[model samples]
Target: MLRLILIGLLLLVIFPVLASAAKVMSADNSHWSTARRDSTGIAPDPKTTPEAVVQVYAARAFNWRGIFGVHSWIAVKPEKAESFTRYEVEGWGVSSGRESVRIGSYRPPDAYWFGNYPELLVDIRGAEAAALIPQIAAAANSYPYRDRYTIWPGPNSNSFVAHVARNVPGLRLDLPPTAIGKDYRTDGIFGVAPSNTGLQLSLFGLAGVTLALEEGVEVNLLGLTVGIDILTPAIKLPGIGRIGFPQGPS
Candidate 1:
């Protein structure tokens, strides 16, 4: 059986909500912008920070209920979209930090929308600047996914899917493949869009038992998503080795 490993890092920002609601102007542009004057009521300050960019999209990501709802803001100093995208977005951000994380799909086109939104309609969604201060301060400097590369970290089935995609062309595959490994204690937080209440899950060890968890977001299955964070002993399994590859290139 193939193991699957999919990862998403939801950098939860504790930002204050704007008094007004904003619509995403474009459904195609990945890099969005707001004019100096707009109804969203955001200030056009010369100081443009990552938290500022994050503030622009927080309302949208929380309002919509899928991966499409989540967006990225490439950082810039004394920010302007042109200089920002050229110097920072395409350059440093793509290769380092959370910006380095890939969705396995939606490759951004030249300074434009990569996943779903278009350029003309990519307006900024307003957020309270005060709420973002803490989250910005808490963000660490390490690469996002680097934290997950550890000992006995859950089923992480998507790893097998990638291996099969690369090594076994024309070979049919199946979902919910068999898995085996010792279980460990784990902690996680889950929530649906537009809801304040979050469900917390804690798992105790004894591997090979596949536990089913909801994707959390209540939108259509087209954007299905789920996560399992595990903490187990550094034991080796007979079938699944430590971070083993499924019949793929070494």
Candidate 2:
């Protein structure tokens, strides 16, 4: 499985440019220039922080990509720690041989993605987070594709968090449908859902299906996934994300 993933990554590296462009794009590249990436004050400031905490966030990727896909990351603060340590894979510098999978790379556990606000997918605080912080870190450190990055069918940001969730199912993280690259994996195509309650099968991240108590049923076609979250009673469309209920709470 590792060999297969390496081959795919090699293909992406060799083919720096695709023959055809992605069907849809984000609003514009300028969003990254003008949009804010600061802390949203959702996670407690680690300076006077008291207990451990773990949070997972997903937001529309910058630009037209935001209209169809999302980026995801994990943040964990050990008990009595001063600040939160974030883990995510980014594609910004891989072409230059820089490591894309970053641990504690950036902060503000709930920071905005470009100009988009994130939806907290999982929250475990206090004692629970204390217990899980080590395991989460281990998984982040253990990610094999530390230097690989592919915008499509990827080891992109979504895939990184999904890998951690698979490694630590206790998080029970359910990435949104718009997390287009979550299906990509370093292991193999077949694995248990991160929730540990369902089955998932993929084909080099391009095509697959997932069914779980938390994720419901999803079908991936050329990296574009469509599914329904029966538990939430929502529909997961190709580009619109979930429709039916306002996510998170007031």
Candidates' C-alpha lDDT = 0.22, 0.78
Model 1: CA > 4 A from native: 1-54, 58-111, 115-131, 140-144, 147-196, 200-250
- Give the per-residue lDDT of model 1 (tens digit) for 1-250: 1222221122111110111112233233233343111223232333443332222111122222212222222222122322221111112243244342232112221222233221111122224323332333232121223223221232221222212211222211111111110121122222111111223222322212222221121111111222231222122122112122221111
Q: Stretches of candidate 2 above 4 Å error?
A: 1-31, 246-250
Best by TM-score: 2
Candidate 2 lDDT (Cα, 0 to 1): 0.78
